[model samples]
Target chain A: MALAADPMAPIAARVARVRRELKDVWTIDIEVGSGGFPFAPGQFNMLYSFGVGEAAISISGDPARPNTLVHTVRAVGKVSGALTRLKPGEFVGLRGPFGAGWPIDVAVGSDVVLVAGGLGLAPLRPALYRLLATRENYGRIVLLCGARSPRDILFRIELERWRRRLDIDIEVTVDHAAPDWRGNVGVVTTLIGRAAFDRHHTVAMVCGPEIMMRFAASELVNAGVSDEAIYLSMERNMKCAIGHCGHCQFGGDFICKDGPVLTYRHLRDRLARSEI
Target chain B: MDMVQSDERSILTRAGLDALIGTLAARGYRVVGPKLRDQAIIYDDIAGVGDLPAGWTDEQDGGHYRLEQRDDNALFGYAVGPHSWKKYLHPPRLQLWSAKREETGFSISHEPETIPPFAFIGVRACEIQAIAIQDRVFLEGPHVDPHYQVRRAGAFIVAVNCGKAGGTCFCVSMGTGPCAKSGFDIALTELLPGTSEPIYVAEAGSEKGAEILSSLPGRAAQPAEIEAAEAVVTHTAAAMGRSLETAGIRDLLMSNLNHPRWDDVAERCLACANCTMVCPTCFCTSVEDASDLSGEEASRSRRWDSCFTMDFSFIHGGSVRASTKSRYRQWMTHKLATWIDQFDTSGCVGCGRCITWCPVGIDLTEEARAIRDAPAQEAKP
Candidate 1:
């Protein structure tokens, strides 16, 4: 019975770089002063904007480069807006590397299908980076991204660079676009039907709006993927990322603790129910 | 965990009761107990035995609470009140940390905890169970709440066996109380309070309690006196005011999430959050940030929050639980159904505070019975 360090206390991490990804989204690289922040693929950090508040933002940086602690934030709320407005030299309080991350080890030697929608892609970026760095370990890596429009797309350059790789297959879709658009023009779930991957061995990781995840999961199920092979990254309002705050509860599970990456087999019954 | 050593029993008189309070106060502990305050029994700092509500008992029902005079001059005659021992351990408001703007970025520092050890007097058995439930939530979880740990680590407990059940009590149905089962240093049962020679049959539940009892002016209780103490709890067990059938309760509520009974309860539930505030085990909280007018320093603090609030489940666009039916359903399901899945134990101890303190008189036991009686054909979306 020894006392542990305070879980709520935030360490001051100085912002090293801020890249504006979209109109309101900014990708921030923070220096945690310790020079190394070891975190898994999909774990999130509670980013605090000084006096504004805290928001649960996923660690979007590459796990190999632990010094470059990164978080991509959308200015959808007060705390996130403040974080997005931060400059390169400003400081923000950081408390995390929290929650269960994506099952990268479980997907070894298996084909990986990553379906991301809007800001949801930021959380999945770390996992994709890991899959590509260890390209020889995994099978066909397919990434399908969906945005409201071409302008709303995140990591546009990175998507193209990854698509250039012969081992990976990448597809981008927009819900609505101008006539100049020359790619997929439907929901991200539609790409699941035509994606080139072994349906029997593919481990699908989907992240997006709850509605989009539900439809994508249903589409995956229709594509001959087992329910246990499909994993979804869910979202909810959160305060304490350490599970002390009860805000992120989804039925029996605390998304902050048990998830934020849960299998469809685990969430199938609870996910279909509304207002859970 | 069952620390109660029933083999050791003693009888204490009125003079001995005063000595117990005096001894606790001398040990540098803040002795808190029930007191007559604002026409109700509230837990507060007590100086002596005079602060105890002598002959007052509370009459409680769904959405109704009144203080009544009892025939006997028993100190702890009433059931639980609106204020629970949580107000001392997990305070309604606590400062987590503070930050000051500096030249090179900023610096953060936690609020140095300075809480005195408390000696909770007159704690009910159901209330003790509630404290244990909170211990699991705060201490036994993956990440412990440091502030709660500091406040709860050194507290002393003195559990009082109930003489009569409250109008809304269901501790027997919850298998929590009527008698002090465990989690107390000492347990006391008031006996013959109306007679000239009133006494308290006491048992030490821990070594600390045995030491304190040895110092108190009490004698070994006769076998007849021990039977009287047991009889008091037996009478209370048979006199539960309400009961909840817990068999298959988890599946019953989880399977009927969309039952119409939720809508019926929502019609009466004002969602004032009074029930959550009064509930002994409701531990949800929200944090707030405050800064000086000069904007040089800022501090963040946590305040008790309820599921009834729209902001409790707010994401970016709007609240997840926007409708009253959804909110009410969330509260009840979390308490009775999902809580068991999350904590491995039911969140509720059946203290009945939620039923009695609800302004609209919405009783969960009735709502549960309604859904159980007529479950929906299939869970609607």
Candidate 2:
């Protein structure tokens, strides 16, 4: 077969490791060649699994290490199922580090609030790393995490280690948890009101299902946070991650390029509709 | 004459049309023109004037299109069909890339296309605008579609100003048709009045058009013939069978998204996506990958997609616009409302293929008017 006349061509990369994070969810560590592919924090890569298919998975690794890219994908469909089953040393096709990254510049020097639900944490993980690495540059950083149950929690060991730090305030929550679960029993939106952060100086970064973001954003708004300061990560079925496929158009904006991360103020009208 | 200035005009007899085709073929160009097929005039490969639907026009309305025989021998008398010029420029199915199984894993190969410049004959003014609109969508972005770029850059446009309007046509309201304003190499107006035989008052829109015109059998058009051609276009403009009220239309659609008018349309709409398939400017697409029986080699391809599909708005959980009402609203709002916000121009070119091809005969202009003219009613879920 002939290669596509497009920038959508993927570069070969080797899967270094695969860790089962939760039920039907995994985090794969991949490494490109010598120079190590450099990319921004919130950008994602199009991972192709041979004959199965391709999908957009966010880069979840530390930005400091550019060569080793990490992506966490849930086994929701065929392509992701194929990806989660790959063993170490297996090669995969990768196309990017495409799309806009989390706005670290605007979040800098301000109190940061990170809210993630279920697998949504994967896209925001790199931003959290940058916040912790430059801890002194930004104000107090709070991480509020949520999942379906205790077993669904991702990066369990890392969340524990982060809890030990005095600077990073972490709150964990789950829905329909077992009776013995010690974390908060309600949704993540409940965690926002009591969470400690200066409302005026805080920059809230949120990523989750569309409904969850809606409730969480409203809670933030009601809590005296301005819409401009809250950023939400938007996802669409992106065929060409560079924006030409037109699959990811959220109204006039191409969610792939104009943003995977758009300010609440910008997307407020679009987000309210049942369909846009 | 002096290299045929841009404003230079000529009279192209029936025989001269064939000579133009010969000129394009001699220059190694594939001439794609409107030909009668499947009872509709579709753009296809044509050898000469005989292939054109001479003396044939079309009657078009919502969910209606049928060929009609005309008294005159004028070519380029029909409205658009289910297919747009996009099928040629931006193809329906395009291979994005391929991954060959390697000893280690896969060796990815990039597919670059070198498309031969094609001569597009019998193109309408609205289609010229449609192609220009798609150019912005594919080319103006940070990522320019290489395939679209290759084909579009290589294309030679030969526009035909409408001498008759279809029942569904509202290109006049959209300010895109009835006459070719720009974005053409050559433009022709077929003037078949009561007195004289059929003649095309042709004008050179670009240097290439002038070069082609110089080779064809034509002479400087008499001043009276030019007036007759202008009269033909003016008559078509006045004879528009459909009209859309565009004053603040974008805001009207955006604000009334939840109006009961949407529910009314949804009741009739089947979500079959025929309108989008026929539209000139609906550019949404989806991609898929296929492998051989060996499973060692694979190729990915992108194909035309419509918002009416359940998967078009799909995420990991489910489709966002699952309901018929939501899907219909997305299509109309995107076409008339959000497209202006995205591309600084309306997505519609006023070529009413959607109305003509719609299975339910859902007229977008009528729907918009129903929403705009009616007093605001409580939105139904």
Per-residue lDDT tens digits of candidate 1, residues B180-275?
Answer: 989998889999745674589998888888888788887888899999999999999898888999998888998898788888888899989999
Off by over 4 Å in 2: A1-5, B1-7, B110-114, B193-196, B375-381
Of the true interface contacts, each candidate retains a share of 0.61, 0.68
Each model's lDDT: 0.88, 0.86
User: Which pairs in model 1 have colliding backbones?
Assistant: none
Model 2 chain B: worst 10 consecutive residues (lDDT sum): B372-381
Candidate maximizing lDDT: 1
- As for candidate 2, its clashing pairs are A3-B110, A3-B111, A4-B96, A4-B97, A4-B111, A5-B111, A5-B112
lDDT of 2 at A115: 92
**Judged by TM-score, which candidate is best?**
1
